[model samples]
Target: MKLLCWNIRGFGFTGRRRQLIEYLRQEEIDIVGLQETIHQDFSMHELQGLSRHQFAWQWLPSTGQSGGIFLGVREDVFSVEDMDRGEFFLSMSVTDRRVHFSWEVIFVYGPADHARSAGFLAEPKNKVERCTTPVVVAGDFNLISWASDKSSPNVDRVRMRLFNDCIADLALRHEGLGANLGADLRARKGALLDQIKVLDDLDDGQGLCPDGWLRRYALESSLMDIYKSEELFWQRRGGQNWLLKGDANTAYFQAIANGRRRKCAIPFLWDGDVLLESLEDISTHIYSFYKELFSAEPRGGVSLCADFWPLADQVSDAENADLTLPVFPEERMTAPWLRNSVKRLVRYFQLGASAATPLLQCSDRAGRPP
Candidate 1:
């Protein structure tokens, strides 16, 4: 069975609506989940227009202009058993007649507001825990799985934490395009359409020569490498000790690395005010406050000891001398065990250093301190 998910942003524009209908008809998609329809109500005419291929749909309308969720299923292919709709999601239980297989699908449109989004994300986990059927949760989460999911240097640590925690706690498997391409194409649906066309053509074996195929393969391989490298870079920046190793380039690991970065961030500071947002300002404020705090003189205090005494009463000169003697000989440091331990530590350090050297160089090239 084929499933297509897209955040169409809105269906208000006639051109976009036509494009969507055309795409749906051309692809002959069996199931689709759409987000940000931006319409509070769908008229009969609108429903007829959207259900071009006899697909039935359920929608959770937007609150004013902000949020909407939609799910559509081809009537000839599957039968919908139950549906539940909310402000942020539209879920349905469906069975495909072709295979007699049934599953639950949760189509989500997470709110732009972080708090609401957190609650919306958690609902699926709860649903999965309670339901016996296999569930496929899909939508525009408005949350990235890694720090490198976007090109921005700064990341929303709190929101990312909540997002990643939800995914991990539920053990959900995330499958999609590479992070770089996803971020790049996020705002350009036209480019995304072109990519889809290319893939379709390639699947039909109707486009590109052996050389072109080789180039495409090389390009994909390079993109995958870069994606994995970026993930590793962020992992290292977040002070993670574990290596990604092998083909661990899935969204689960990316979410994990993003969560680690969030935790590693300085969320807030205890500067008189409970939380300070500016890192540099907070650093300066904390440094000055602590410096003065440590430098301040103490007030009057009572002394616990009455007087001082010599150590002669506690030990003889020979005993004192013996106690002061060094515990090991100078040559003892050269023992095989000690030498081996030190060598092992050095080797480990070198391995880690080598692994991190590329990240350091990249940071330097970007004119950022490592």
Candidate 2:
């Protein structure tokens, strides 16, 4: 079961989308966990109609009402169970028929400016410390990992200690089987806020390879007819990936980190080579890790200041927020606000949330004509 966890950044692109289709077509990945989906309604269409993969998806909302996560699994191999906690998180269970074993998968959108961020690393470390099951955790953690995985030529001082402590604290079982493309992965070096850990499994015996090419060795199921896909690529953002596309180059990525630039509606990864998978766009890596056993949770609706939120119409300037609004889909603040609202409301219905949470009162972060 090959799973791809990624922070796709955004789903707007044409060229980058093509490149993504090309890769996934070759990768045929299974579970994809995402975060910062930045969409109002977390629709299942991205997965349900994704190429030939039959799947289910769920979107979780954040306390500030601006972001969340979604997960997708190939329908043929797994079964899905929606865990609707639209208020703070999104989750689902995927089961394989051969082994009735099932796991819960959670998509998280970390609070950028919250007190919880200060105290929760150890909390999860302690929480997962006793865990003994398949758990795949991936996302743009915002926290920095030692800059390299086991396959790295050498571990950095800061990165090494952080990972070691996590292992000791989480009592995590093992790193997933890998080509250990650590050094190869950061060939250009300079990566922040992304990592994947698998419990109950150690390196699949293959040590690190010189390049991250080990992905080539994995079995791929996503390959739908290449010819047909090339013809159907409806990708709109052609120059976003910067990696594969000429315009969205790494220079811009560096600028963002160096503080040489400010946030743009531009996404981190936007290219045809990188399909703007809403779930994958937000979450990345080890998606199947917690499908069944590991468990840690959000504080709940009690922590949210629901009153601070603007009415859908008032949302246009809502703290100045809005979702799926054409005005600024590229802007992080606006899109996430509306995306999660829609996701929260939709999920509220899907999970059979109390009828009191009336969807009618809800407005797309940017209030529109009723």
Candidate 3:
């Protein structure tokens, strides 16, 4: 079955709507999931205009002008057994008309707000765990699976880890265009190299013949295509943009990606003085450590004051006294990092908590960092 998942940006524009309908008809899309529709409602005629073939659809209204989700299935192809919606997602249980096979589909539009992202990511787990049928979850997660998934240098390692962990907990397979292209390039390279080798042996020690030379030229052209594909794949993996370079520098790009992988890897974990080298051991150690660390329940009447945060960085007593002392109206004091309330200080502690915690929990439960 064919499925199209897209962020339409908004479905309000007439031209865009017409173009989308035309494309849907041309492509014979069986299932559609659209995000950021902006509009809260659609008329029957308007819904019908999405495609000539009748469709069963479910949609969530945009919260203000910001976010929305729409899911549809061609009525002739599938029967909708059930449908549901949450603040961030639309889910449907569908049965195939031909095979009578059933599955669950969840189309999501993750929150754009970082503060709400944790709850958004956590929301699907309960639904997924309850499902007896196979599930396909797709949409714009507004997250990257890895730090290198985006071109921007400002990386949020914590968010990336949490997003990846959520995917893992859902038991979802993450695939991408670059991965498919990379696999195809490897297969093509193998075949091309074999053919080139055959041509080389055939032309061995012979005065260069036009037929052999032509065949070699064709092989060279194919090699160039492979190089271009490899370059594209590695460029994405390395998170680098290309300039007008005459040559495809696949090696350079691959090196950059490899360097990133190395920097992100933890070869071993220290458990007290002993190092955990085995995968199973490391996994157990981390799981046990964090499980114990956060297992503490809050006792009644327990609260924290500023100094109670022993591991948190502090303003010295002198600095505190200076701030508390009366100041002339003309005098001004500015602490740039501390300007934005305690948010930056709190975030700093969060990132640097490793100073106290020392070992980090692997990004994946399998004791491997991706």
Candidate 4:
């Protein structure tokens, strides 16, 4: 079970969304979580169209509703607790009666606004202590990991302090897998802005992030950074989707974003100055990209895991490469990896893009730097 996450700005850029979809294809992900979903009711329902797994979104209105929350579940997982309370946290669960194995999943789009990050992040930390079931929380914490304090602009002390408080207060385990901790100037080619947080340390606390044996997974991305704007894409307001794997639920539903008229967030695509004519085109673009990537079977005969991981090359060494061809998988498959990926892409375009536009970003957000 693999979870992928990222915060792609606005969720509207359908053009670059295929990269996210293909990422899922490449990583063979299970559950996917997204943040900053900007859309209204009808516009927010884009998740249903995607193939493979069932999806749920919690699109709180930005105008009157707070924006955030999205969860996509694989078909085999058996989803339960799908709710759209117009809150920052959205929930889902999967259980195996026979094995007595169960898991509860949460995709939280915590507020980046300094004022909002506190209460939301704390409550969860406190609850995990007593919950009988194993809970995996993924998505942007909006706060730097305590390990992120190594260099550069110091993480906000108040926020950092609050996060540390949670660590002690809740005694929550760190199960993050530390996928985004690798962001650095070298990784960004001399720039100090790689959006993902690639941390070297795993949670020494409980067991939040994966470490040691889970090193290769530190690079998979569920979110796509279409706009190269360093500020927008990296630490500030870029687009991203946070995924929570483990025992995820079956397909349920949540609206990514629902706003009123005019102020509604829009994903505008343009040719220099000419605005894109249709959002429908964005969907087509994703489908085409997917076809190109997965049109054929896996190459260089290898085990499915081997095809995904260089570490797994042992499984494909010697004669195995000449044996069975590994499966890279499609997002439309009944399995967790496929359904989770495909659904995220579908909702991304619908909620992110306009009814008739392309290019992805919050063009309506005033003072948005070009």
Q: Which candidate is the best by lDDT?
A: 3
User: Which candidate model has the greater TM-score, 2 or 3?
Assistant: 3
Candidate 1 clashing pairs? none
Tens-place lDDT per residue, model 3, 1-370, is 6799989988998877877888789999999999999979978988887888999988999988989899999889899999988888899999866434588999998888888889988777677887899788889989888877889899888999998898788876676654455766786688768877877887775555887677677767767878987997887764544453223667766675788999987789998899989989988998998998989786778445434445335444443333334433343344542464255345446545534223222233332212
- TM-score, candidate 1, is 0.47
Which of the two candidates, 2 or 4, achieves a greater TM-score against the reference? Answer: 4
lDDT of 1 by residue, 263-344 (tens): 8888577766566878887788879888998996875675323222233323344533332333344435467646654654
For model 4, residues 43-145, the per-residue Cα lDDT tens digits are 4345553334554444444433445555666655444543333356665666522222366776666675779778877666655654567676767666766
- Tell me, what's the RMSD of every candidate? 29.1, 37.0, 30.3, 37.9
Best candidate, TM-score:
3
Better of 1 and 2 by TM-score: 1
Candidate 2 to native Cα RMSD, angstroms? 37.0
Tell me how far the alpha carbon of residue 23 in candidate 4 is from the true structure, in angstroms, after superposition: 3.5
Clashing pairs in 3: none
CA lDDT scores, all candidates in order: 0.68, 0.47, 0.76, 0.50
For candidate 2, the TM-score is 0.37
Q: Which stretches of candidate 2 lie over 4 Å from their true place?
A: 14-24, 44-47, 61-67, 81-90, 107-109, 112-116, 119-133, 147-167, 173-370
How large an RMSD does model 4 have? 37.9
Once model 1 is optimally superposed onto the true structure by TM-score, how far is the C-alpha of residue 258 displaced, in angstroms? 37
